[model samples]
Target: MSHAPDLGSSAAPGAGAGQREGLGELFSSVTEDLSTLVRQEIALAKAEATQSGKRAGKGAGLLAGAGVSGHFVLLFLSVAAWWGLGEVIGRGWSALVVAAVWAVVAAVLAVRGRSELRAVRGLPDTTSTLQKVPSALKGHEEENHR
Candidate 1:
């Protein structure tokens, strides 16, 4: 299943020091290139993971902002109601009563926001899955060789 080019047809060498080019030197150069490539790929992977984390963080922050804004809206509405309904309910007690109701509303919204945060935890797990794929493939290679 390897996609590597076959070395058989090429002018690539075997174990002869002066034979066109040393296989060890060729292998060393190839390994050096591979190492550089792997390092670059790792950097790219890290950047991708960091981006995903930022996106998830932004999403969670947005949800929290929504919950907070909802709470503020309800609280402000209750405050507005208190101003209007002060005559019907007792003047001093209406503000306290309205605030109590709005507090309950805020609590409910907070609970909902907490439930929504669970999905953000999956983001890092997604990146970890990607990181493990190479190791998993290497394990398969070992099994095949056995």
Candidate 2:
């Protein structure tokens, strides 16, 4: 009877070692990729924050300019109206009438401002998401137990 070669003994000596080395290289590559991803995400966040801040600054500057120009316009218009009315009525009566008109406007503005302030719902989405965190954690705990 012919004897067959032992299959187990025919295997290469370095095969297991080569496989272990490949695994180590794969793990290192994965770690490096994850680290790079985190760095990229942080860079993106910083860039977005910088862009938002620049936009907010520009908007504030424009609003300030508009406010100053609007104040000047109102001042000139009020003076013109007072002079025109003074020709029909006396200067004192015309001034009093303008003062009363401004008073009514101030009252209306105050009431509207109060209503708008009351309508403000601060960070509703953030509040709702925060409330879900505990339930989410509980679900994870149940999964782990199973």
How much is the lDDT of residue 98 in candidate 2? 61
Worst 10 residues of 1 by lDDT: 137-146
lDDT of 1 by residue, 1-146 (tens): 99898877453445343564666787787678667756766776676678667656765765676677567667666676767576765654666666666667666656655565544443454455446546544554233222
Evaluated against the true structure, the overall lDDT of model 1 is 0.61
TM-score quality measure for candidate 2: 0.43
TM-score, cand. 1 = 0.42
Report RMSD (Å) for each prediction in the order shown. Answer: 11.9, 9.5
Highest lDDT model number: 1
With a 3 Å backbone cut-off (N, CA, C), the pairs that clash in candidate 1 are: none
Estimate every model's Cα lDDT from 0 to 1: 0.61, 0.57
Which residue pairs clash in candidate 2? none
User: What would the per-residue lDDT of candidate 2 be over residues 1-146, giving only the tens digit for each residue?
Assistant: 76997667656546777888999998898678667755765665566666655655555554555455455556655875767666775664566566566555555544554554454444444444445545544554233222
